[model samples]
Target chain A: MNILNGSAYPNNGVHLNKRHRKAKLFSMLCSLVTWLGVALLGVLLYQVSSDGFKWLDLQFLTSFPSRFPYKAGIKSALVGTLWLISMVAFIAIPIGVATALYLEELSGQGRMNRLIELNISNLAGVPSIVYGIIGLAVFVRGLALERSLVAGALTMSLLILPVIIIASREAIKSVPMSIRHAAFALGATRLQTARDHVLPASYSGILTGVILALSRAIGETAPLIMIGALTYVAFLPEGPMDSFTALPIQIYNWVSRPQQEFHQLAAGGIIVLLAVLLMMNTIAIVIRYKTERKYK
Target chain B: MTMGTFRLVKKDCINNRGTRWGESLIHCGLALCTLISIVTTFVIIAILAKESFGFFEEVSPVEFYFGTRWVPLLEPSSYGVLPLVWGTLSVTFGAALIAIPIGLASAIYLSEYASHRVRSIVKPLLELLAGIPTVVYGYFALTFITPLLKTVLPEIQVFNALSGAIVVGIMVLPMIATLSDNALRSVPDTLRQGAYALGATSYEVTTQVVVPAGLSGVMASFLLAISRAIGETMAVTLAVGATPNMSFTLLESIQTMTAYIVQISLGDTPAGGIAYQTLFAVAGFLFLITLLLNVLSQWFLNRYREVYD
Candidate 1:
């Protein structure tokens, strides 16, 4: 209609304005949507902090969970979480990093190798609960670990193994191929080349993945539950063979109780879990940012 | 060449050959690491098959597959799994409804609208949401979200599926946003430029060019998020009740398959009994559906994703 107009200038300003208005509206909506995540985080933190702050004293951190919420603490659960994370780190990192490096070598494009690749991807997508089932069957019952910390750690290791492997693979893949090729051109063995160049280049990346995996393992409860680590032990675990309850499991037990005070106690447990998670995430970000800046 | 140089070269050659044996041994060790994941898959399959097989022997396949009743623990127990599957799907569907649009919008906003500063700040914060444990979400759903929802709608039960759906939606939101952002960011800038040259608004360029270009990835993100929701255990178990009612109503409590597995696992059913075996059966079904959704997500990206140089 504007083009058909005979005047030098057409009168479609309203139409153009409407289009611009729509664009502006959409831009605002997108910005709002983008911040919804951050918003949710803020709200969640606010809610938990409000509910749990009264119970977040030093005594709460030192005492074992008791029948009374006022006396309850995260001592046993926190220790178990630390023990579990340490065990998982010991078990998952070396294996996850090795798998990533082996896959990156591109040694043989064999059918079996491809199958392993596919298997890892599928494992990453498998629900964490399924890993719990596997833990129940193989670790708890089949191996007769009797719901020990070893069984829980082994199961948690498997649960986060795929995440670590995938992240490490990505990190290794992002290491420019030219670095490896140049090392090979220098007549260095694959092992030597990886050790001297790729390993240094990818260590931070691997650290980030390992931290993420360990953090996931720390927060994990379902697989532990499936493994029947349900003992409400007022005492700390003495060994890997001892039964344990994790922070998340403790929180779950607390939340299930029909008392308002127990709910507050669960909130306190959440604050501790979130604190640990935040610390791990902060370390990951520091490693990532430091290395990223050094490279760039 | 001098004799000294000749001897040094010979020694180097010998050293290289000697270490080759050690290198191959290390290589085998690394290869073993890769094989562990494969072994894990097989063990999962074997366990599921063995336990579920026991369950199927006692309960007829027809009833287990088609029967509407799911009273695995009661007298005169029925074995139909349809309601549990429906409950799981209903929650997944509701979660998808909440997650997809907001996640896509976040993807678009970060990739197309937000400046670098905002993107960097918000992305990690979003990840923090995903990093928080599911049990925390459960606590929030029960204490915060349920009470909040009840204030608005009084008839909504304390253990309704809506609370579970809402929290699961929140739990998977970061994942969806992050995945879809990658997809949208991967769409070549040249397409956006061309759309701009054709006088398209920023919104138009995103919706028509960018989103359409990253269609499969966005769709795959949706699928993966849905898969995550189905496997969500703690939040649903705590927020959604363990009662396996056949009702699909949002106000009524519903038992999801994950919730059922948690129920039986938390119970005192003997390890070898039919009730105990039902956990594996439900888990096997849960695994199959989530696995299928995952594979479908992969297939969507691989088969339909638009490739740009």
Candidate 2:
């Protein structure tokens, strides 16, 4: 239409302006959609903080749960969470890192090796509750471990093992092939190279990954619930075999109760959970950045 | 001289019995360690097969699948799983409805528009969403979201599907956004430049060129997120109602398969009873559904995967 008239420049200007306006509006809409996640986080934090602060006190952190919300505390839950995480870390790190090392370095590309790789990825995708069922059968009944911290920790180790292995593989994979070859050229054995150079260089990456996986393990409730972690435990675990209740289970128990105070207590429990999660994530991020700088 | 040095090194490597012995031992150990995952899968399948088969023996497969009700605890129990399936699907459907568009849009913005500074800030913050415990999300739903929704929809029940679905959607948003962002970013820069050279707008370039190129990955992300929502137990157990009703209404209380598992587990059902068998049966069904979706996601990822180096 503009080509037909030699002096139709102004009309074309208006047409392009219309399109530009529509495009700008559409882009703005996309930005709004992008903010949905941030918006949800904002609301969640605000809601929890508002309800949590009033109930969050030293006493609340130190005392045991009571029928009276005013007297209830998360001492047992906090202690149990710490015990569970420590046990999980103890059980998962060595095996997870070893599996990654074998698959990435030592193992040949055999059919069996490929099978292990496929199984690990598939296991990573399996639901946590299924892991719980396995725990119920193997740990609780088959092994006769019962609903103890040891069983829960062992189950969680299984749940997070694939995650840690996958992450460690990524970390190990990032180490330059030149570094290992250089070590080999210097008469360092494969084991010596991996131990002396490769493992040291990738240690931070492995740590960050393990920390992140442990954070995920900490928040896990389903498998633990499936394995029948006690919800009303008023005492802290004294040993690995002792029965335990985690923060998530404690919060779940509280939320189910009909009392308004218990709901407040649940909110308070969330604040603690979020804080622990945030701290772990912060440490992971710091480790990741530091390692990245060193490597690069 | 170089050959002599090489021979000495080779001899040293060959003669290091301790190192050779230790290395082989370590290799065997690690290889055995890696087999744990395979054993775990076998154990899960064995347990599910054994227990679910028990359930099927007691309650016929025809009735279990075709029956409309799922009341295992009540007298004269009905084994129809449709109600539980309906409950689970409705929540999943609701979550997908809420997650897909917003997640895609967020992916587009992050991949196509956000500067590095903004991307770094926003990306981690979004991940923090995934990092928060689901139990907290459940608490948030029960306490905050439900009350907030009550203002808008006065008739909504305290334990309705809407709140659970919305929170699950939020929980899933990070997975979709992050995965889809990677997908969108994987689209070659040349494609965007080609679209721009054709005088396409930014939105058009994204929706038509980049998104189409990255469709499988985006679709894979959706599949993965749906599987996640289906298997999610705690938040749904808390926010979605526990009653095993046949109704699909978002406002009514309903129980999902995961929720039902939690219900039976929480109750003191006698060991090796029918109630116990139902837990395994429901879990087996849930496992199959999630496993199918996961395999589908992996297939899409491998089949349509693009490499632009």
Docking class of 1: medium
Candidate DockQ scores, in order: 0.51, 0.51
- Per model, state how many residue pairs clash: 0, 1
Docking class of 2: medium
TM score of chain A per candidate: 0.92, 0.92
lDDT tens digits by residue: candidate 2, A1-296:
22223243345455776756767887788789988789889999998888888999999899988888999999999999999999999999999999898788766565666767777887888889889988888898889998999999999999999999999989888899888999999998777888888888888889999999999999999999989999888888999999999989989999988788898899899899989989998999898877673544
Candidate 1 residue lDDT tens string, A232-263? 87888999999988899999999999899999
Indicate which candidate wins on lDDT. 2
Error of 2 at B263 (Å): 0.6
Q: Lowest-lDDT window of 10 residues in candidate 1 chain B?
A: B1-10
